[model samples]
Target: MTAESDPWAAHARRTVGGPRPLLTEALELLGRPRRRVALDLGCGAGNDTLALLERGWTVTALDGSAGALALVQERAGVHRTRLTPLEAGFHQVPRRRYTLVYASLSLPFTPPARWDRTWRAVRRAVGVRGWFAATLFGPRDGWAGEPDMSFITAQALRERLDGFEPVVLREWEGEIRLAAGGLHPSHTLTVIARRLSR
Candidate 1:
């Protein structure tokens, strides 16, 4: 899709700043790793991808929008060699293990019909003792009933992370400004979990 018509492109343009706080926290939890391979799932404008690259992690920036991938490449500069841009939807995510699987605000956009499979793939992608950090929308979010989007409850989220050890699982609700430019009621569940086994 053209950058003008792509919502992700606009989002990338608007969110052009530092890496996400959850990501920073996850990194701190992981300390220094022996292998620095990471997957930036739904990696919009490469905010987290750039952060991973800067820290010497080989990152695969996955996104569905060509415009978003282009922006990632443009911003990668010297880090481009360590960055691999994959153009595909969430359902098509590769089932390969990585030292880190970081999905910022991307999991909420996965369609309900595809969530189970997508999530399973995501879970499998995390290597043993690897980190998985993501933000999922709760049922009270403004976009909760958008048909295609998936929203979860605290209990459900905990159930989903059954095999993983939770490092950070915080839930909060409030009015927040949207990237598209409007105040909206949002309930978010931020999680940083580590795969303990298989």
Candidate 2:
């Protein structure tokens, strides 16, 4: 199937599972003013991008697919004033200071060799006391064996998240349909962290 047929289009079809129940707690972290800027890394058609915008955060939507960006632009409507859809590779994307950085299920696509650089990029891009939420593929994910994909064991990932205090670290063991429409019930790991003080 062609890129137009990527099954991820379906995943994007689904809404964010639920409003972040921890949002109030997160908001309390802000001393006075609310966060104004946010980044949706690997924003994949801007599903979460839309969610963030709805909450009044100006968003920079980044995705590797032109098609995805197009869809985002269309869905966002007048919110376009607050949205900047970037079509580019993760490596080419510059580090910008943002209050929240969300990667969803997309960072797993970053090649393993580039994982360290990309991880550091994410850490450096967000502002002091910023928030980060993402899903990482565990070593046991079926795709872990894929030569070019990045998958880390929970231990390794925990180590990578060393400095940040995790607000949520959850795991799932089940079949996950791929972006290509194939099914692989595998191990999935998700983490949401926040920079505290530093």
Candidate 3:
């Protein structure tokens, strides 16, 4: 696919920024005092990865694009020692435990056929009382039915959060202006839940 047609490329170009607001808010709400190991799933451009590193967390930033991973590594600069950049798609996430498993605006991009396994992998990667923060697309999202993507309703989402004690579960819908000067509607569920003791 062409650069414009590839969602990962498009997002990498526009991912310049500090930590996402949702991430910052989630951390504030959790109030966890210790630095934790983090897995930044689909870490496009490393915005969230940088945030985690700044807070003294060891981070494994994984993405499907080699270019994206390169950018993340470059952004890590002197802190590269704490950042482990890996090139892998959703289905290839390695088996590992983490104190924080974060996926921001990326989980929905998992191909439908592999989503079940990916979800299971995601859950298994979290350590006891660890945090899981992510942005999941809702059924009303403009990309709801896009191929290779997944969207869930509020009720279904609740069912999936069974092992996580919710710290923040917020739903939002609005129009987002694209870099192409077009508008796209978005409906998303932002979650910041702590895993229950297992």
Candidate 4:
């Protein structure tokens, strides 16, 4: 499909020169020690992947959309050597360890039935003492009940984050303004956590 007809492509194009506040914050929280590798899971438009590359991290960027991966490759250009773009869904995430795993607004897209398995794979990818930064949809999110989406309650979140030392825990429950100029009541939990010892 043409970029005009593909929403993912259109979003990737729009992200080219935009400010990525979440990525900035995530990097700040991750500190400046300069890790060697990172995995940008569900790297929608490659903003996070680009940021990782700019910071001198060899990155593996995975997205379900081919158009999104294309945008990532296009944006990488000279940095292509440090960037690996893979077009695969959540179920196809490769088994590997990484110093950092970034998954912004993407994990919830994993079908509810497959979330546990996916989370297991994600944990394996992070290994011990690795970091994880992501946004998880809360039960009250507008899209929580969607068939293919997964949502967690506050208590459930605590259980899920049990082994990690949460560096940043920000929760919001209110109307979210969409890029399409529409608003929807939503709840989201943004986290930057480090695996302490395990």
- Report the lDDT tens digits of candidate 3 across residue range 1-198: 567556675678686788888779867876764658989999988999998888888999999887778778888888899999888877677788788889999899998889988888898888888889999999999988899899988888889889789888889999998655789999999889889965
**Candidate 4: tens digits of C-alpha lDDT, residues 3-33:** 6667777776665664256667877776775
Better of 3 and 4 by TM-score: 3
The per-model lDDT (C-alpha) reads 0.91, 0.73, 0.85, 0.81
Model 4: CA > 4 A from native: 2-6
Q: What local lDDT score does residue 142 receive in model 2, on the 0 to 100 scale?
A: 77
Q: List the residue pairs that clash in candidate 1.
A: none
* Local accuracy of candidate 2 as per-residue lDDT tens digits, 83-141: 98887666555667888777766788988788788888888776777887777788888
Candidate 1 CA-lDDT value: 0.91
TM-scores of all candidate predictions against the true structure: 0.96, 0.82, 0.92, 0.90
Name the top TM-score candidate.
Answer: 1
Instruction: Report how far residue 81 has shifted in candidate 2, in Å.
Output: 0.4
Q: Note the residue pairs that clash in candidate 4.
A: none
Backbone clashes per model, in order?
0, 1, 0, 0
